[model samples]
Target: MVRSKKTEDDHIKVAKDLLLASILPNVEFDGWSSGAFEQAVIDSGVDISLVHQIAPRGAIDLAVAFHKKGDELMMHGYKQENFTELKYSEKVMQLIKLRIQASNTHKGAVRKGMSLFALPQNINEGGQLIWKTSDKIWNTLGDKSTDSNWYTKRTTLSAVYSATVLFWLCDDSDEAIDTWNFLNRRIRNVMEIEKAKAKIKKTSFGQSVFSFFDLLQKPSNEHKSGFPGYKG
Candidate 1:
C-alpha cells in the first residue's frame, strides 16, 4: 500500500498540529479553569449554546470570557449566543469572520487542491509527472507508444485516494470506519495493478530485445527466418 499505517498516522499528526496552531493564536486554551469560563458565561446572563456550535473549542472559550467581562461586544448582546449570531450583529460579525478565517488558514492538513496532503515523492525515478505509487509501475512496464490504460489507472488511483481521505475527514460517524474501508480497497487496487504491470513488463522486455537482435540479422536471411528484416 502506498499509504501505509505510518502514512495514516502522519496524516493525523499533521492534522492535529495544524488544528492546534490555527486555534491557539486567536483563542486562549488554558488560561483559566473550565468552570471559571462557564461561570463567566452564566454571570453575563447571556445564552451561549448557539455560539458554542460554530466556534472552535478555543474560540468558544474566548466567547465565554468575553461574556464574563460583561462587554456587550457580542453582536446580539445575548452573551450566551453562538458565533453565527454574533455575525448577525454588524461589528461582532466581523470579528467572527476574521477568527474563522484564521482558523481555516491553519487547516493545511485538509486535502484541498494545494493543501498539505502528502504524495509519494520518490514514486518515479525520472521525476515524471506521477500522482500515485502505482504510476511508477505502469510507467516502467507499459508501452507509452500504445494504449493509454496505465495513464487512466494512475489517474483513477489518485482520484479515489484523494476522495477517500476527504470522506474520512468529514466522516462524523461512530468510528469513521467507512473511510478506512475505502482507503484499504483503493490501496489494494493500486497494488494489484502494479503487480500485473510488473509481470507484463518482464515478458514484454524479453520479447522486444529478442526482436531487436533478430532484426539486426542479414536481410537475405529474412525470408528463411521468421523474424522480419529491419527497414532502417
Candidate 2:
C-alpha cells in the first residue's frame, strides 16, 4: 500500500524527534557538531541515509528544530497561565521568562546552539530566530498594531529577549533572581523609550516629523507583495 504524503511527513517528523532526543546529550559535549549528529544517528538507530534526507544541513537543522521546539513549548505554557490581571509589561516579562525556562533542562544544548548560531554564516539565521521569538510573544499577547509600531515593538522586544537570554546564561544567582531583575530593568528601559516616544508625539514638531515618517512607512500587511524597499 502506498503511503499518503501526510504519512510520509509524519514519519519524517518522528525520525527528527528521535534524532533530536538522541542529540541532546551529545550536543552538551559536541556542541551540535557533525560528530554529535553522527552519534545521534547511531543512538537513534535511524538509518544514516534517512537522517541525511531529513536534516539536509546536518546538525544545523536539528539546532533550528530545537529552537523551534522551545518556542512551541513556551506557547503551550503561555496558554496554561492566567495573565488577565497582569499589566502588559509584566505579561511581556513573564513570556520571556517562560521561554527561557522552557529550555532550562537543556541549557547545555542552548549554550551550544548559541555558539553555533553566532558564527558569521549563522548570524542572520540566529537574528531571524530572535525576531521570530519576539514576534510570537507580541502576537500571543494580542498586539494588533499593523503600522511602524508593529516593527518597533518587535525590534525592542527582540533586544530585550536576547539580552535577557545572555544574562540568564551567566546568572548564578539563587533561583536566577538576578536574571529576572536584569530582565525587569531591560523591560523598564523599553517602557521608558515608549513613554518618551509618546511624549514626543504629543509635541507639534514631533507630530510633524512622525507624520512625515509615517508617509514613508508601510503597514505590515503591505509587505506580502514582496516590495523591494519596504523594510519590515
Candidate 3:
C-alpha cells in the first residue's frame, strides 16, 4: 500500500499530539521544550524536521495547539451528551466542566502550558486560544446570534472559562467542587446580564446601541486562526 500524504493541518495535529504526549509524561522536568518535541518525533516515528515547519514558535505553538485540542475534545464530548433533559444553563455548565475534566489527567502539562501562555508576548496567542475555544463552544451549543450579543456572549464566556481554569489549577480539594461552584456562579452572572440585555434591546435606546454594535461586528465568520500551527 502507498502512504498517503499528510496535509498541513494533519501535520500540525500529528506533530502537536505526539509532542504533547511526549511532553506530558516528562513535562515537569523538561516542560514544553524543543527537547520534548524532539523526543516526540523519535517516540512517534514521524519526521523530526517537520516540527519546525509545523510549529516555528516551538513550545508556544504546541501550547496553543494543546488548548485547541481541548476544544476539539470538548466538541466531541458535547455531541455525545443527552441534551434533551438538560436545561440550557446546565448544558453550558456541563460543556465547560467536561472540557476541564477530560484534561484533568494532564494537570501538570496544563500547568506548564498556562505558565507559558502567561509570557508577555504570548498574550495575544492566549486570547486567541480562549476566543477559539469560546467560539467553538457556542457553535457546539447551537448559538445563532449574528449581533452584538454574539460578541458579548463569547467575551463573557472567555472570562468565565479562563477564570475557572485558573481556579481549577489551585484547588486540590475533593474533586475541585470549589471550582465548579465558582464556574456556576460566573455563568449565572453572565446569564443574568444577558437576560437584562435581552429586555433592554426591545427599547429604542437599546436598539440604537445594538445598531452601533452591529457596525462593530466582524465582517467575516472566520475568526483569526493565529495559532502558529494553523494554516487556514
Candidate 4:
C-alpha cells in the first residue's frame, strides 16, 4: 500500500492545485472525482515500496491512501452508523459536555462570519442529525426517572443543538452569536422539562408506596358474614 515518492508528491500537488483551488472550495468532493488523481499516480509508475514508506504529502494523499485502504478519513458520513455506542457514564458525560461547548463556540463563530459556500446535501439531512442530537441528549440524562417535564426539556435541548449545528455549517456572518443565543434558549427549555419530570417522579413514587398499603385492606363485612354462613 505504500506509494512511491513521486506518487505521494503528485497527490499533494493535485490536492493543493486542483481540489483546494479557489474554484472548488464550496464544491462537494466525493470518491468518484478522485479517480483523476489516481490515474495520475498510475501514470507516474513510481516504484511501490513499503506501505508505510509512502510519504504522506498531505490531506490529498491521505485521502487517496484511505480510499485505497478503505480507512475512514473523518468521523462523518454513514460510517458513524457502525460507530460503537458510547457508555452513558461519567466519561461519556464529559465527552458530550465537551462537544456541547465546542458546538456552542463554533455556532457563535459561524454566525459572526458567514461562509460563501454550501455544504453537501448529504451532510444537511435533518433526520439523521436530529436523531444524533437526541441520542446524545438521552445518553446525557439516561434512565434518571424523569417525568413529562423532563421529556419536554430533553426535546427542547436536542432541537436547539441540532438547529444550531445546522445553521453554523452554512452561516456566513463574521460572528455567529445568533446561533449561540438560539442554543441557550433551547438548553433552558430542556432544563425546565428535567425539573418537571423530577417532581412528577417523586409524586409517583410516593403514591406507589401508599397504594401498596391500601391493597392490604380486609374484605367488606358483608362478604365475611356470608362466608361464615356457608362454612356452617
Each model's TM-score, in the order given? 0.27, 0.89, 0.83, 0.33
> Candidates' lDDT values, in order?
0.38, 0.86, 0.77, 0.39
Residue-by-residue lDDT tens digits, candidate 3, 37-114: 666656766565776766777666776777777878887887787888988888888889988986888888888887
Model 2: residues >4 Å from true position, as ranges? 1-6, 216-232
Error of 3 at 86 (Å): 1.3
Better of 1 and 3 by lDDT: 3
Cα RMSD for candidates in order: 24.8, 3.8, 3.4, 19.3
Off by over 4 Å in 1: 1-161, 205-232
lDDT of 4 by residue, 100-209 (tens): 44434324322321121123532333233333444444544453423443344344545565466665566556565655555556555655765765575579685675
In TM-score terms, which candidate is top?
2
lDDT of 1 at 94: 33
Where model 4 places Cα greater than 4 Å from the true spot, the runs are 1-126, 133-157, 166-174, 205-232
Q: Per-residue error at 212 for model 3, in Å?
A: 2.4
lDDT score, candidate 1: 0.38
TM-score of 3: 0.83
Better of 1 and 2 by lDDT: 2
Order of the predicted models by TM-score, top scorer first = 2, 3, 4, 1
Kindly give the number of clashing pairs for every candidate. 9, 0, 0, 20
